[model samples]
Target: MKQKIAVLGPGSWGTALAQVLAENGHTVKLWGHNPAQIDEINTYHTNRHYLPNIKIPTSIKGIKELKEAVIDVDAILFVVPTKAIREVAKEVAISVNTKPYIIHASKGLEQGTHKRISEILSEEIPESKRQEIIVLSGPSHAEEVAVHDITTITAASEKLEAANYVQDLFMNDYFRIYTNTDVIGVETGAALKNIIAIGAGAIAGLGFGDNAKAAIMTRGLAEISRLGVAMGADPLTFIGLSGVGDLIVTGTSVHSRNWRAGNLLGKGKKLDEVLENMGMIVEGVATTKAAMELATSLNVDMPITKTIYNVLYEGKDIHQAAKEIMLRDGKVENEFS
Candidate 1:
């Protein structure tokens, strides 16, 4: 069955998702704030600013106005970065009347407020207008998804129906979607793992071999689980697709922006310089601060996150931070309790 889908962002991830939907035989509207990007998608069958090389399908239309994009869509996939989800959602809510199913692909906690993307949407969209509210997440990366690689992700929501609905829309040969009820855990796992990936990248960039990278990835997951559990997420979910699965993929994959940003940081580049050169939003930088603060407020033990927070925000040296973490560890192996 064909559905009208609106992708509420024109970044790489959003464009990739729109491509997937178009491949699934759905009519897709790819919305962007940039007029040139919208024009590229509409007139040239490409998105020059993001996902430059991939050719967009003719079925996927591009729209600059939020209202124009949301019109008559059966599902609206919010694929904006976490930092911008709230603001975009706010703008969307005011003009949207179609009451389409809300599916979010963003992964990060809001800064200062420490609110999850779902929470932000809850506050922004009217209570009566809230859709099933689905979150799509897992080990999938945008670059791979654009090329029609075999990618698996989980579609989760508090409501089982929402998960099933999203699963039906996104599932296909190269793209697999699993349904889960642990929305909180899935979202937290997806958001928090990026921060850990940054640390993993830093470890890799410091000339540390596989062993060090493995340790960083492992310990980073431990901290992510600890904080997530404290915030009412299921611990077992952390070991599943959205948790450890995502950590392994992002921490090691070269496609991860967070990992690349951390690699430059470990190479001794300043934060501003790294950000400027990358020309993309490194979500983990902001997410780390939000996660660290949230963990502190919840009294959760997140030493790895704390150390990364110091290295990124407080100007602590990466090597010094690693040494401190290495020396302070005195715990039994295979015991996560």
Candidate 2:
């Protein structure tokens, strides 16, 4: 069955997701704050700046007004940045009167609050107005997903029915979706991998070879799994798509903003300069701090995450941070999360 979907965010991920819905024969309204981007999506069917090579389907209309885009829609898919999730949900609260499935593909915990995107949506949007909050995430890169490259992601919800519904909404020949009941594992795995991607990028920027990338990704998975298990997630979920799969793609891909930012940071660029140069949200910068705090509160030991936090926040030398990490006492790999 066709549905009316509102996608909030016109950046790379949002635009690509809107294309998926349009290709699935759903009515899509892509909402954004930038007038020029909105105009390009509607008039030219191209979002050249964010997605340079792909053309948006004409069935996907671009709308400037949040209310205009979401009103009467069967589902609202938030592809915005982590920080913008709450603000957009607040608008959805007052704008839509009917029940619509509230879904989010944005991955990151709230910087200061350590809340997941679904939590922010739940806090802002009343349940009476929505079916359920669902999370869509995995190792997908918008550049590739937009081009119809083979990709698989997970849709998670507390309820199996909600997860299945989301899976059905998105699955296709090239784009596949799997349903999971472990929302915590899926969201944390999705969010924490960005930090590891930064580490992987930093290693590459420092002229390290594939050995360094593999080391960080492997150890990074351990630490990410540690934190996830501590936070009440099933440890097995960390080994699945949202966990190891996402880590591989985001940490290694040039298309990841977090990796790019980390690459610049490893190349001796300051945080502000790296962020400015990327022209997109490097979620790891903020996620590092939040994850550090969360780890502390949970008594979860994340050595790699801690080192990245010190380098990013305290301006510690990356080489020294790397040295410190290397000097740490070794541990039995199988015992922790």
Candidate 3:
């Protein structure tokens, strides 16, 4: 059965997801804040700003107004960056009368507030006007996903039926979706992995070889898992796609913004320099601040996250940060036990 899908963002991930749904024979309306981007998508069948290389399907129409995009849409895919989720959701609440299921593809916790995207949605969208909230996340990068590479992700919701429905909507030969109920773990893993990816990028930027990256990635997962568990997430979920799976991909992939930022930081560039150079959303930079706050509040021992936070915000030296991490008190392999 074909569904009307409203993709509320015209960035690379949004365009890629809209293409996938359009290819699957669904009616997709892509919402963009920028009129120029909308014009390019509608006229040229491509988003020249975010996704320059990929051709968008003609069936995927671009809309500038948020209300027009949500008109009669069966499901809403929130593909905007984490920073914009709340603002968009607030606008959506005004336009949407009927409660539609929301599937979030954004993958960072809100800075200062420390709320996940879903939580923000719940707060902004009135309870009576909201349906089951689903989170879609994994190691899948938008660049690779745009090219139809084999990518697997998890579709999670507290409601099992909702998760399965999301899985059906997105699952394909090249794109696979697994259903899980651990929304907290899934969201936490998605957000925390970006911080780790920055760490991995730093290692690479510092001229360290694969061995150093491998170690950072491994330890990065440890900190991510620890923070997730402390926040009441299932420890096992950290081992799955949203956790270890995402960590492996984002931490290593050159396509990752967080990794790229970390690489620049490791190369002796300042935070402003890294952000200016990337010219895209470096989620880890903001997410690192949120994670550091969350960890401090929860009393979770996340040394790597703390170090990244210090380096990015406090202007701490990366080399000295690395040395400080190395000099920390050693513990057993399993900190949870």
- Model 3 Cα lDDT, one tens digit per residue, 1-337: 8888899988888888888888888899999889988998899998776776788799999999999998787889999989899999999989986778899999999988999999999899887776899999998888888999999999999999999988888888899999999999999999999999999999898898998888888888889888888888899998999999999999988888888888888999988877887868888889999999998898888888898889988989999998888898877888463
Task: Compose the digit string of candidate 2's lDDT tens values, residues 1-337.
Answer: 9899999999999999999998999999999999988988889999998998787899999999999999889999999899888888898999996799988999899988999888899999988989989999999999999999999999999998999888988988999999999999999999999999999999998899998899899999999998898888999998899999999999998999999888988899999888887888888888999999999999988999999999999989998888889899877777274
Please report, in order, the local distance difference test score of every candidate based on alpha carbons: 0.87, 0.91, 0.89
Task: Estimate the TM-score of every prediction.
Answer: 0.97, 0.98, 0.98
Candidate that scores best on lDDT: 2
Give the winner by lDDT: 1 or 3.
Answer: 3
Model with the higher TM-score, candidate 1 or 2: 2
RMSD of each: 1.3, 0.9, 1.1
Q: Which clashing pairs does model 1 show?
A: none
List the pairs of residues colliding in candidate 3. Answer: none
Where does candidate 2 have its weakest 10-residue lDDT segment? 328-337
Cα displacement (Å) at residue 61, model 1: 0.6
Predicted candidate 1 versus true structure: per-residue lDDT over 128-180, tens digit per residue? 66577889999988889998999998998999998999888888999999889
Candidate 3: residue 267 lDDT (0-100): 90
Better of 1 and 3 by TM-score: 3
lDDT of 1: 0.87
